[model samples]
Structures are given as C-alpha cells and as structure tokens.
Target: MNINRLVWIIMHVAANIKNYKFSVIYLLLMLIVSCRRSTEIGAPVVNSSNAVLPAPTKQLSIVPVKIDTLVNHPVLERGVIGEWDSTDVLNPSVIKFKDKYFNYYSGFDGKLWRTGVAVSNDGISWQKFVGNPVLAPSISDWDTGYIAGNGTAIYFAQRIYYFYQGINDRGIANIGLAVSDDGFHFKKHPNPILATGPAGAWDSDSVGDPFVIEKGEALYLYYLGQDSVGVQRLGIAKSVDGLHWTRLSNNPVLDIGAGGSFDENGLGEPSIAYQPPYFYMFYTGRASDEIRNIGYAISTDGIHWKKISTTGLISNKLRSEWFSKVICDTTLIAVGGGKWAVWFGGGNLPVPAENLNGQIGMLILDLGQQRDMTSFDANSDWSRSLVKSTDVLLGSFEIEGDLGKRSTWLGPKAHLTLATTDHAGNSMAGKPIIVEGWAPAQFISSKTGQYEPLTISISINGKIAAKRTFVSDDMFRIEILWPEIAQLLDHTGFVEMDMSADRAIVPAQFGVSKDSRNLSFKVTRIYFH
Candidate 1:
C-alpha cells in the first residue's frame, strides 16, 4: 500500500484505541520511520549545509550535449536522373555565398570520374549545373586518363580556387589545381601541383584527397598519402599564393593507429577545420576489417596532432544501403550554434557491377557538448557540487573516453538536475514545448540489465509538471517529448524547466552499487513546428 493510505489506517486505529494511546502512538512512529528508510535505501543522502549547491533554478545549466549523428539523411542521391552523372556521385565540397549554397562534387559516368557543380538554396535539395563536367581530364597531360574526384574549393582573392586529385594513364594519383571565376566553369593548371614523394618516403605511392583552408595569409593543404607498403596516411603542404607549395617536415602528420585499433590499417581522406585555439582534423580510418569510418584529432599547430579517438566517429554502421562498407573523403563546414555539417563519400564492397556506385552522404557533429561529465581534471569546476538532493564526489569516478575525449563517470546514487529557459524569450504557457535528450543506461552488470528503462521527470517553477520513461538501444543518445507541461504554463512569465534523472545503480556484494547518471539535455534547440 502507498504511504498515504497506510498512514491513514494507522491514525484511525490510534483514535479508536484511546485507552492505549501511548502504545499506539509509539507503533505509528516506528512504521513511519521504516517507510522513509525503505524509500531512501539505495539513494544518496545530501547534507545541504556541507554541500556546494548548484546555481539557482532560473539559471539554465550550460552542460554540453552530443550531436545527433543520424541527423543528416541522404539529401542528394545518385542516378535519380540519368544524365552526366548516370552512375555515381561522390566527394562534396560546399560553400555558402549570400543566400545560395554551391556544391562542387565528383561524378562517374561509367567511364571516369569528373568534377561537376550543383546549387541549392536550402542546402538540401540540389539542382545540377547545366554545363556539367566543369573540370574534366586532359588527353595529353599528367591528368590524362581520369579526373579522380575528391575536390576541395575555396573562394579567395575574388576568385574560386579548386583543388582535386588527378590520375594519369599509369593509375598514379597527383594533386592538381583549377581556377574558376564563377563557381561553374573552371580552367585546369598545365602541370600537377604536388606529385608523389621520392622512393622509400611515406608518401612515395600517391597523394590525393586535398583539403585546403586559408589560415592567416598562407593556405594549408591536407591530403591522403600512401606509402610503398600500401598504407594510407595524412600529410600537410603549405602555400603562400595558393599555387606554389612546400610539404611540412613531418611529412605524414598522422600515421596509422596501433595494431588492432580502428585506424590500425591506415588513415586517409583528411578534412580539417580551424576554430580558435584548436584545429580539428577529421579523417577516414581503415581497420583490418577493411571497413572505413571517420575519425578525428586536434592540433595546436597544423603539423602535430593529438588524436581524439582511436576509433572512427562516423563508422560503417551509420552508412545507408548505397554506402555499404566505406564512408570517407570528409569535408566539414560550420553551421551556426556549435554544429558542423560533414559531407563525405560512401560506397559498398564486394562490388557488384549494378551497385558499384558511390554516393555523397552528410552527417553533423556538435563539438560544444562532446566532453564526458564522469571524470575531470584539476581545472574542472563541476567537482564536489550537489545536484538536487544527490551528492557528487570528485576523484571517485571510473574513467572512460569517447569521441577522442575522456568521459566522466556518474557514480551510483548520483543524479543531474538542470534547468532551462525558453529560447524564444517568452512564456511557453499555452504552446507546446518539445524536449529531447539522451538517457541510456550506463554500466550494466548483466545482459538483461542493459534494457532496463530509466525515468525522466520534468518540473516547472517548483512543481512537478510531467514524467515519462524511455529505453534506448543507443545508450549514448535518447529523446523525450513533453506536451503536458505546456498545458500547465501560465503564458505570462518565463518558464523554468527542471529536468532530473534517477541514479543509475547496479547490484553489489552486500546491497547495491550506485553511480550518478550523466544527464545532458537542450531546450533551446527544440521547436514546436
């Protein structure tokens, strides 16, 4: 029975037995104490006076959340129309000018890959340029046989400079440059700008998949280089005028990972972004399984790198039917709000002639909230803070890392409660406010325990508004919708959303071992429409 009903019965008996009032009163007190203890058996106790309290409920927690890896569906597919790109389309490089977005991509016409242009207003639906094959192969030069695609474009000095990989009759790949006044039509340079390295060098085999970015006055070119051993790695080349170039001393800036690691076999297909004090490099890591996925690393300077993870960020599992085994040739452009749009090439293996085509795919990454909350360094401000009624102890968490960063372990009996203010900066009393977040069960002891559902409670002001439960296969991500909370709003003042999750616990030798569950959610990004 519930505590309320049980208390009522105890009180009724005590009133009728007035002669034994002292005995009845004593028994009632014991029962109430036992109930309270049972309810809080595995829960952590908080000492309000000793604990450092969280910020006021009106102050929204700025904790970062992971980006939805599956947000980008195939915006552009190949062979939807049987024209110049009748077979396959791949390697997309995008630039936004004014209101329109331009995509320079490589397409195969059953013979050789050639460069093409497509334009879009919303960056989703695309219309191909009528004059397709803006950059094609030359019959008598180094790029004689095929203009093998992977093109990187930058609008600089009032002109668009296009860099691509060109293959000769001997099947050797070299970096070539092309110039265009408008984004559609382009003229190729007479000779290869960067050829293969000398014998016994790391990049002696071939260098392709050029990614160019203007850092200050100089332009840095990052590309994939293969050695005589057939292992692919990444290398950097610098240029002043975006034409003449010099390779960095540490030729292969990033090599293959350790044996049995995700990038153990090779690392290639570099895409780089320079944001503030850090330069992020996202590349394709090939494993022994021959499956290719996207991985990332960060560098203070463009030459030396610290890998974010040994595994790939965008793996083969994220690939669609057209993208059976590989997802490489990444190109990233920042979309506002701490998010980036990544475009890459994806294709299947055991190549069937009818389905041998590769297509361009897109995925998004949010760098802002990618850090783990379980562990921290001396500089962390979150250590030893009280989250609602739960106590958080610093230096007491298990260490783990994901996406190239260390993950903080939420202890058993720990809970994260965060408040959010509406992004519209108005009352959401009548209108529905959508809520989404990831709440996966962490650190399960048994196989079945992994499927256990977690509870989510949403409160407004100081009163409970809505509650729900969800079980997710993706332990790293989940979403919840709350319409009931909307009905409770008054539509006058700012709405404060207080979100909390129960402590994640596992069985122990004596009783139960409990840990805090990381609760990261965002209210500003959710929209009703």
Candidate 2:
C-alpha cells in the first residue's frame, strides 16, 4: 500500500476500535506494513522492532549489570625510601571535582609531616602531584611545627573547603581551613578556623581531626578534642559558611568509653556517613595499650551519638593484611547502592599516633539495600509508608504506575523481612515459598573492564543458603526455592538477597534520566508461593 492510503486506513481503524489494546496492535501492524513498502521501493530495510531508539531526555531503561570488586589494597602508598613522603603517607581526605579524585593526605618525612595532594581518575590508581605538600606548615604562624594528621575536604558552594590539623612549635594542635578552586592548589585562611577550648574545659589542650558533613541548612563539623590532662574525646561544631564555626553547648558529644572499654584511651578521626534516618560514625578508638581501631556509632541529630558496639568495629581480628597493626583516619565516600568506600590510614608498627609505616587503604562497606522510600512512589505497597502491613517487606522496589505490575530492582544487597504472624495473630512459623522473577541482559563492567556473568544469592539469617554463581542473565520466570522459610528467617524474621549484580549505576550520569537513584537488575515480579 502507498503511504497516504496506509495512513488513512490506520486512522479509520484506530477511531473505530474503541479498545486501546487493539489500537496499539493496529499501529504496530501499520509500522510493519510501512517498513515493507520502503523495502519494496528499494529503500534500506530496517527492523523497527530491534532498532535502537535515542535515550529519552529523562527516564532510562534499568539494566542488569555487576561491577568487579574495587581495589582493596593500598591505592596510595608512601613515597620512595628517601623521598619527602617516604616514612608514611596516611590520613587521607578525598573529594571528587571535575571528574577526578583528589586525595589530600598527610605525608610524613620522618622529621616533618605535611599535607600533599594526589589525583586519580579512578579511586584505585593515584598519581602524586609533582608539587607536593599543597598545604604545608606556615613557618611564622601558629602552624609552624607541622601540618598533618586526620583532615577532610568537601566541595561546597563551588569551592573546595579543606579542614586540616596544624601543630605549632609549642606542641599545640588546632584545626585550619584552606580554600581551593582546583584540587591541586590551595589558599590558606590566615588564622586557625578552630582553636582549643577554654582552659580546664574538656578540649582545653588542643583540637584537631576535623570532619565535616553538610546536614540540613548548616555544616556540622565533628572533631577530636583533647584536654589539658591528656584525655581525648569527640565533639561537634556548627557552621553556616565554611569559614566561621561555633562549638555546641554540650561539648564532647561522644566521650571516652567505660573504664575498660575499647575507646577508654581516646577517640579521633571521626567520619560521618548518612543513610536516611540515621547518621553513621566511624572513628578511631584507642585502648589502654595505645592500640587504635575503627569504632562504629549512630546518631539522629549530628550533635548526639550512640556507640554501636563495645569493642572496635574493625580491630586487630578484623584488620586487613596490610593494615593489621593500626587503622585510623577514616575518609568515607558513598559509591551508591548502600555501599561506602572507607578509605583509611593503616600501619604495621603498633603506635597510637603517627609514623607507624602508615599507608592509605580502603574497604567497601555494603550497609545493605534499604533506602527510605518516603516521597518516592509512596503509593507502592513496597514503600516505607505501607510496608509495615505487608507479609514481605522489600528493602527497595518500585511499581509501574498508580496501579500496575510491580518490579524490584535488586541492588548490590537486597533485604526482605517476613512477618512471623498474620494480622489475626496467627503464627506463620514454617512455610515453603517460591519467588518468581525475570533477569536482564548482561553488560560490560566499567570498573573491571570485563564481562561479568549474573549471580543470584540467597542468605538465611546472614548465612548463605544458595547461590547461582553463573546463571544465565536471560533467566525468565526465575524461581527461588525456599523450602523451610521458618528456618531461614531469623528470630526477627529477616533474610537477605544478593540477587542483582553488585554496583548499581546512576542513570543521570549516563544522560539517560534525571533519576539520581543507583538502580540495578530488573526483577519484573517477585512472587512468593
């Protein structure tokens, strides 16, 4: 049929077909018919069904892909044996600007410690700036002794604000600030931004190790506070502009642990990571033996905090091969999908402070896939608003529309909570179940530069139940068998899934959609039989 005749027929049929489904089918048929006519006219024959369409200005197709484990070793090592930073290179503060990772770390040159800058495309490989010690001690100022130890950087208001520790010749340490447009160079603020507390106060001796988090309308700075009596603790300060600051009335937000606890000696290097309702703190806790390890804490308002554990979160037992002796100076970066890149300082020689062969290392902490689903798709049953009443509480998922088919885009870690009892209070202790879903097509890994096979894993109460390591990515009507659901669910009735590929991608980064959520594999429907 000719183009005009084909168009006339489609319009007439679409108007008469009252049912929208039939109208859609008729339009598809018309597309095929027109393509055939083009081929008959000696034009290029293209398969409309399989033809690639330009990405919408907004909204991207969710894809199924996984990333290889990032480099866990020390990405930024100490300099050559006799170089300026030969002794140790630790206490890293990193910020991403202009598509590059700028790591500001303390480099110990045996006699002096200075702050240096290193650049990296990926957080894994780093190249030290030829002009090292971007921010050194001002020989004639209060920071005449050295400028080093736990520091942090943040890009705020189109500028990089660097908070660092500087000690003077009198052995007094205080927090200083430096502004940088480019990550490589910096302009120091004349005087110290934060100094010691009043005499006899908790932080009278010195104050340093400044870690800042942009909370709400202001900037909350958490730091290490030392008293004249040689006791150390953690405190919080508030600021609107990055320059000025004020300490909270209730100083020392997190004090030393109980008499024989892990942090009895002191606390330093506080790092904050916010995941919705809770703010997580990872700090260096010191013991009586002068041993230092990473401790975990949680807070609602940035000023108040509660320690998560009695022992250190990462102590000698949980230490990595290279950082076995000491671990301090936490620099946390969230790489999406509930995962945090904890870049820290570690050393071999056991010491409470600096110069222990200190090197920078990183560990990825997957806090699980739970995200606060308040405003986003509130109508979805899987949302936080309605999930309390459901039998299976999904960590994260989305519905097609107001009332359409539901799909769960499983992130690196997925969590499901089963209701042990029904609304009528009837026990549902033991029950077999089956989950049906659909997987997505495989894709190449941008991080590892390799193609990864899909893997689906089920864990019961933190223990691995089953794992399809190399399953076909095209697996449809996927059935996950749970023979004894009761045995799987913990006392609190919690279970976890590692079904999707690790590392969810942000659609906005690829210019696909304005959606900033880190989305992963597609599970069209998850049915519990």
Candidate 3:
C-alpha cells in the first residue's frame, strides 16, 4: 500500500479505537508515520516518537493578567485636588445602556463619599460627566452623612433604578433607591428602601453594596450586611416594584470564609452576572491581614450560593503601583463570547473602605462556553499530564489546599474541572480517567448514635460516570473508561466530577480533632491515562 494510503488507514482506525490501550498504540504509530512523512516532505523530522503533548491552554491557567493594555492607566482616575473625587474614585457600578456604558462610582473628596457619573463609549476610555456628583448627600435628610455609589443601577421598565448606600449623621448605613429617566439625571426616593435589620440582627449595623438583577417577574438584590460586631456577610432581597424590598427569610445567603481563608475578615461589594443555569457573583473578600481581593461564587437559584474556592479569583498579582495594596469592589458586564468586562476599585493604601487612594481599573475574563457532546472532537488526544491537584477549577470543597497529610476534605458534593488541552481544544472523552481519594466508611451520628455509610457518585459533566458504596474504611481508586459517545467534556472543556455522598460526617464525632465540618471524602489526586 502507498504511504499516504497507509497513513489514511491508520487515521481511520485510530479515530474509531474504543479501548484505551489500543488507542495509545495507534497514537504512537501515527506519530512515527508522521515523522517519516515530514522528512519526505522536506520538513523538520522529529525522530523521537515520545514527544510530550502540550499542557492546558495558557488562557485557562491562573496567572497575572495585565490591565487594559491600550491605556495602562486607570480607566477612571480621581478628580483634581479640590474636586468631589479628589481623594478617591472607587466602587464603580457599571451598566450598558443603548450601546454605551454608564458607570456610577463612589467619589471621596477627603471628607464624604458621593456618587459621580462617567460615560464611556467603549467601556474602557471613560469621560466624566460635567454635572458631576449627580447624587450627593442631602443637607438634613437621612443621607446627610454621605451618598455611596457603590451599588447597582439596573435598567427596568424604561427607567433606571439606582440602588445605593446612604449614611446618616450617626454613621449608620442603609440601602436607598434613586430613579433616573435619563442615564445621567436622577431623583431620590423619599425614604430608604432596604433598611438595617432589627437591633442584634445580622444586618443591624449596616446594609450596603447593593447588586440588583431582574429575574422572571421580580428583581433580586444582593448586598453586604454588617452586624454590630463588625462581621459582614452577603445577603439577598427581593423586590417587585424596584422600591419596596423584602429580605429573604434566610438572610445572609453567603457568609464569611473559614478561619485563615481569603474572606475571613468580611465580604462586601457583590456584583452578580447570569450565564444560564449558573449565576456568578464577583465580590470583595477581606482577609485577616486586611488585604482585599475579588472572590467568586456560583448559584443555580441565586438564593443558595456556594463559593468556588477559599482563594480570591482576582488577586493582586499584577502588583501595579496604583493598585499595589488591594483590589476589591467589582462591577461586571458580559461582553459576549464568555468574556466579562470587570471594572473594579484598587488602592495603593491598605485601608479597607473610604479614602485609601482608590482608583478604578478594568480587566477582561474569558470564561469558556459550554458545548454539547455532539460537537466534541473525537480525534483529539488528552494532555500527557497524568496527575492533577485541587488547585485548578475545583468546586464545593470544604476548604482550600493540597491533598496532603493534613486532610483536605470535600463537602457532600464537589466538582473537579479539567480544561481542554491547548491542541485544538483536546478533551477527555473516551479517555481512561482515575481518581484516588480517601473516605471514611461510616460515622456515628452524634444525635441518634446511628452509623451512616458513605455512598458516593461521580459524574462527568452531568452524566453519571461511576457510583460506589464504601462499607470498608479504606483508600479508594475510581477508574472510569468514558465512552466516546459520552462527550462529557465537549462543552466548556470541563470534566465536572459531581461527587456526592449519602451524608457528610464531622471529624469531631470520630474523636479525630476539634474541627467541625461536614466532610464526605478526601480527594488526593486525579489522573488521566
């Protein structure tokens, strides 16, 4: 047979290989044949048949991404020395209106915070409105202290509803509403829409940083609630007429992070976006060290939220001089193709809020789109890296860290996502995937004194890949040979191992330690062969 015909036959058979071992052999044969053809075609011939495959795409990896390269300065800078925003220009709430971007940001004039407007045609180059400080503190009203623009401006019913934070003379903060027919002009409501909770309530001290989005028939507002003890958390409220809001019965939907976590100190400045089946939140997380960064969370119903990780999604990796100290207060805009235009506040000084030399910056995030199984490239090979840790795209884990001697446990359900390889979006479909983890067989229930065995189910994307019941207290290895027809990772290049157990157990019940967490299993490592 001709060399070209032999190569064609090899490709045809290799594409249809079902068994992993046979598939590996065919892939090696193709590499050898390609090398020979390269020499014949006057191309550089790679003699070694063991050339390693490329790693995951650089775009998917976690690294220091630069700000808008076109203009490496703040998209919105502080005003002149005596202007309203002379001290700080931060906490931007941006929305696209009629093909233009309207940013409502908080401005500090060394004394008080006021709302200012900056218009942008491209969401990058911003021009401050001549009629600055569009919303200022009332002379003697409830907002006599300051008017914060660190809130949401949502367009609904041909009118823009701007929810903002207002402080009284006593330094108490509450959420207020303003109406705007034109994007620049506004009229304040008579009274505060969402007030502080009752004394000793979770939000008795303050409720600010409102992020409102309209769902089916009602509007959902996510905001930050601070208690009397200075503990801040995230909560949700519902509104029908954009003025009157009812806090969720189970308020403070999202709590602060665990001890030693990125958000251990507090959480605030929530900005939400919808990407179908999942609602994403980009909020500010303050660590115990007083360093702040942007954290991410996801939800299906927008009421119940699960944080993706203990680490911040957008950290101070760039180390830019202007934002060298902290990065917080996110405002997101979906700019198509899984790209989000995120405008946030950064500071060179370490102050958490108010005046810290705050400036506005922007970054673009490319979160891949979900694809169906029918569109998967069956011919692509998986990456050569066989071992992966929990650092990359892990979700619902009880805490963050490596699977070291000190156990890293997952909650009742967890997901491990694998990005497609760099080569033509290589996927893990029809590949031999293995996961090694440790799970306690049974745990004695503290309340009833009954033992509950671990029943775990693993899924790829949404398809059940493996399920097992562990009665013996032993380390387990789950190997699933995913069928080619099940193109699980085709969409979004993600392999979601939806691990669930019958029930989670606390280590304190086992006399293990003082730790109290609902843990299902310990995922040590994942391998693809």
| Each model's backbone clash number | 14, 0, 1
Which model, 1 or 2, shows the larger lDDT? 2
On residues 429-499, what C-alpha lDDT tens digit does candidate 3 reach at each position?
56677767777775434432566666888877666788888765668888877563145554234454566
Per-residue lDDT of model 2, residues 309-331, tens digit only: 67776645456577776777878
**Per-residue error at 161 for model 1, in Å?**
0.7
- All models: lDDT? 0.55, 0.59, 0.63
TM-score, every prediction? 0.57, 0.59, 0.59
Residues forming the 10-long window of minimal summed lDDT in candidate 1 = 31-40
Which ten contiguous residues of candidate 2 have the minimum total lDDT?
31-40
Q: Tell me the spans in candidate 3 whose CA falls farther than 4 Å from its real position.
A: 1-72, 370-529
lDDT of 3 at 235: 78
